[model samples]
Target: MASDTDFYSILGVSRDAGKDEIQRAYRKLAREYHPDVNKDPAAEERFKQISEAYDVLRDPKQRERYDAFGPDFRRVPPDMDPADYARARAGAERRTSSRGDPWGGGTGTWEEWPEGVRFSSGSAEGIDLDDLLGGIFGGRGRRGGPIPGSDQEVEIELSVEDAYHGGSRSLTVEGAGGTRTLNVKIPPGVVNGQRIRLGGQGAQGLGGGAAGDLYLIVRIADHPRYRLDGRDIHVDLPLAAWEGALGASVEITTPGGPATVKVPKGTSTGRQLRLRGRGLPNPKGRPGDLYADVKLMVPHRLTREEERLFEELAGTSKFDPRRRR
Candidate 1:
């Protein structure tokens, strides 16, 4: 709040800018000024400025406060009345020096910010400054003493086969105190990016507050033979040229197990053969279907007899791939 530099000016956006506009400005500035991408020594400082600006503007409540009273918006609690904020601002002004701020942390008063280091958290835009402030001033400002610990998020990766069948797995969740292990039951037919909630498994709360929940974000690992889309599964079914042209019973492998799919005569590449109820099963609803995608394979090195037979077929058959039928 005490700084002469305006955050809106730093992000190159207007004071009345919308959230999307603010975010766009932040992204453009961040990419241009990021130290990893930009070699200019000043770029690091500019990047921090944009990041700090975005962190405030992105949060609705925070943006409201920032709009009302520049950086010192943080000096006054969100729930405090405008009259109380003025009084607190006066009190903070009297308590701190010209160099100090009441809204900041680390070697500064509550209305100020430390140089060079805005936020170091590795989250979406780095640390949540509001959460950090809440944690800091919770004892004085909050009525309930301390809120429940923040929910923790962790990604759990599963193989295609494991995801198809579903099983039990163990994982380590990082907490404020340290790391703890938990047993997770991967529900059958859980889709990618789906979250599984674990109750009361987050960080320990302060002042006897209730612990928070843990969320496991499901991430399915890439499989060599299988491609999944929602409840449907696609597997490439390799067939010889003759089998594709003349039809044959071909044995193909599915995520569950190996099965046989009959290739109809005149089957073409990219042909999909649906096998009902052969994909992942959903406990809550209907099971998924599996589709075998045909992939025709021609012999790379043919014997003399095979070449002669192909030559004879070429002379006898009237098949034109390029001609429209």
Candidate 2:
């Protein structure tokens, strides 16, 4: 019931091929015969033929009309019955065979038509090969070409400590296609709003096109102690009043680990001590710095001995309280 030039036959799909199966077949053939990829002179024309077949078969409406009316479906009236059209075409073929016209002078089969009859829509009394070829190819210049897949972006949240140390993380993404889990690698010193590209992991392309890339935008989580500003980390360093008055080596917690910093003898509140390369680790550049902001704390209640010492110092010291510098 099918000919070599039939849309389904051209695309190498059966009459009952599903949409996915048809697409797969078309993609396979397109990759082999696409003009851009294939340099053979005959390949261009072959590609056009396959592209035309795919264009019509890919659409449900077009495919339905094509299945009902064959290659002349476009010329057949929408309201016309399939049986009536078949009867009319058979009568026309018989007339053409008797006249012995230039259209191969035989049965009006698809192969008997001109070598390249681009199917298009228009009014026609009967099957005119030249008219049909010119009408279809000239009307809408649509063809099946490889369309590059679209890039997809997703946001991933990471803790400050996780960001500090580069490691592998398991991420599950829920989308219209359902849920899929991926093992993502987190780079050290990745700042907020940074994007990590995963090649060939985006939306699938059509007509054997290249798959797009997937971008993972990093969002750093807020930490209780550490404040992130780019790669630099800021943390409040609480010290006793005595520690501020006299320099001492105090231990502090960093995203990396614990580190000891020396406080100056005249250290005051709001003073920051800089620690080089103690912040987040940089995978591809210089590491970040850490700032320890000093905050002096005084005991709400002190023992009698501590109060006496404080009073003695207040009485003996020449440093006037609240004196203008």
Candidate 3:
């Protein structure tokens, strides 16, 4: 049967996607749309759609039934046939008397049949007793039980240094219970795309169901002086042309503090000075190394004396940078 509510689209998976693909899609979307994590007005509705899709697609039997009956699978029997429904409909119409009374409220069909008599409608719109009882007893109804709370995911922006060192921070969210503040302890070495889960911080549950969790996705802000690659740290070390020709020692800022590094003679732009174990620390491995890349610069505007010195060097120096030796 054709379906309007496509589970594949809800979870962002292809129609022929495998089980793992569907699960991964759900997890990724769950982190973004979970009510506690995302405070946007539409997040809750989006989360519900994905959750409902996941609930059915994750189950083998439910998935098969859903594939066959669309969203109405839950309300219709899996093994029911079209001919069976036709027969049931015909039987209900046959049970209806010429009179219009349903339960013999008037001096109608039931009275003529004596006591303990019941009647059905006389057409396709007639009510089938089995269907009515099944709906009332939750045999194949859409809504039948308690529902768990929705999970939430939100972004928490942090500085590059803050991610390296870790610290305490605060966050405020407009939850189902209203605006609330939470104090968060950031773990050391936390990196971009990492998530911090806070349990019981999601949407309120229904019918005594358990509340969901909240996830904080880390987004590290850019830095003017530093660039990070995994556990590695990189910084530009500016130098004059003369410094590149005749080595010198210079002080540079690192995450730990200021430190002096020797600039080897003949250093060129893009040359890196490695400082072992000075980058971000990791719990599972050794700390990353820091690299100071050379950045050669010249005076924006030369002074008279500096211009004279440069003219003299141009006349006397034997170096021919563009010529092949």
Candidate 4:
């Protein structure tokens, strides 16, 4: 019953959490609420629930099957009959004891049993013990059969530009056996550690089980021009001395494209310019804002004529950089 808890919710992790993330969350919670340390009335139940969730999620095969069929999978009807099932299981043990083939030996092998021991069906005339034994001793059928292949994990790195505008990328995954090329679609505004699931791309299932999924974890590379905070984008824009002294409209680059931003006249080095709806897109279809911090740049090496102009301007004006400080 404890295993019936939703694996994702029980682990306090998202459905797309990576293996290490899930393991870490489980370990943290397990340590905090372990029954041995917490003697509350409900401690044992909570601990069992946490352990159950980890048990299935921690195993690749079991997790794949659980993900494919959900929590009710264990209740699915088994393929074998009750009587035959018991006999077949017992035969497996006996065979193992005698060092014979435990899994019903290949197609047409006769099972050797003791002489004169007749297991009778209650009707009337005793049934041939050998026939009953043969039917029960049928080769050990596949146990648990083949399950859908385990899910695979791959990490992908993206540039900030790519993350701003949705794009497609080609990636190669190297596994124990070989490599596979996958074309992945990167959605706009995909943040670091977000995962994309590719269904039916995992290991091949045993028997008729469906294939597992392939998960791609996104990693966004740092950009020298901009810094990100949630959906907002921040950038420090350089302004000419005149532009900082007098208000001006300047062109700036944004993830969406280039835009003209109005800089208030007399704006200081730390003045902020805001462009709305230019940031990352939110889940509710709203976009974040872009913030520009204006920084003034002074030109070096003035010409003789420029020196005279500055001399006259300085005599007429009373501007000083250290006045505030």
Per-candidate Cα RMSD to the true structure, in Å, reads: 11.7, 21.0, 11.5, 12.7
Q: Which residue pairs clash within candidate 3?
A: 34-151, 34-152, 35-152, 37-152, 37-153, 37-154
Residue 314 alpha-carbon offset, candidate 2, angstroms: 1.3
Top candidate on lDDT is 2
227 in model 1: Cα distance from truth in Å?
1.3
Candidate lDDT scores, in order, read 0.69, 0.71, 0.70, 0.67
lDDT tens string, model 2, 1-325? 1123788878888998999998898778877875445779987567656766776787899799999988766444445577755654554455445444534423433332222333222222245543332323221112323444556668798899988887899987655446779998887778665557787777665445566667786778778988876688999999998899898999988888889999999899999999999988887678889999999998899899999999998889897648989
Q: Which stretches of candidate 2 lie over 4 Å from their true place?
A: 1-145
Tell me how candidate 3 scores on lDDT.
0.70
Q: Candidate 1: where are CA atoms >4 Å away?
A: 1-146
What is the TM-score of each predicted model, taking all chains together?
0.58, 0.56, 0.55, 0.56
lDDT of 4 by residue, 120-186 (tens): 3233233343344333423221333433455666779887788788689999987654788878888
Worst 10 residues of 3 by lDDT: 108-117
Winning candidate number (TM-score): 1
Candidate 1 TM-score, C-alpha based: 0.58
Please tell me which model should have the higher TM-score, number 1 or number 3: 1
Expressed as tens digits, the lDDT of each residue in 1-325 for candidate 1 is: 2134677898888988998898889768766875545779887566655665776677888778877766556443345465544544454445346424434544422332221113342223434444434433322223335545655668899988888888899998776698888888888887654557787787766555567667786778878988876667889888899999999987778877888898899998999999998888888778889999998999999999999999999999999989997
Summing lDDT over every window of 10 consecutive residues in candidate 4, give the lowest-scoring window.
Answer: 115-124
Indicate the worst ten consecutive residues by lDDT in candidate 1: 108-117
The regions of model 4 sitting more than 4 angstroms off are 1-144
Order the candidate numbers by lDDT, best to worst.
2, 3, 1, 4
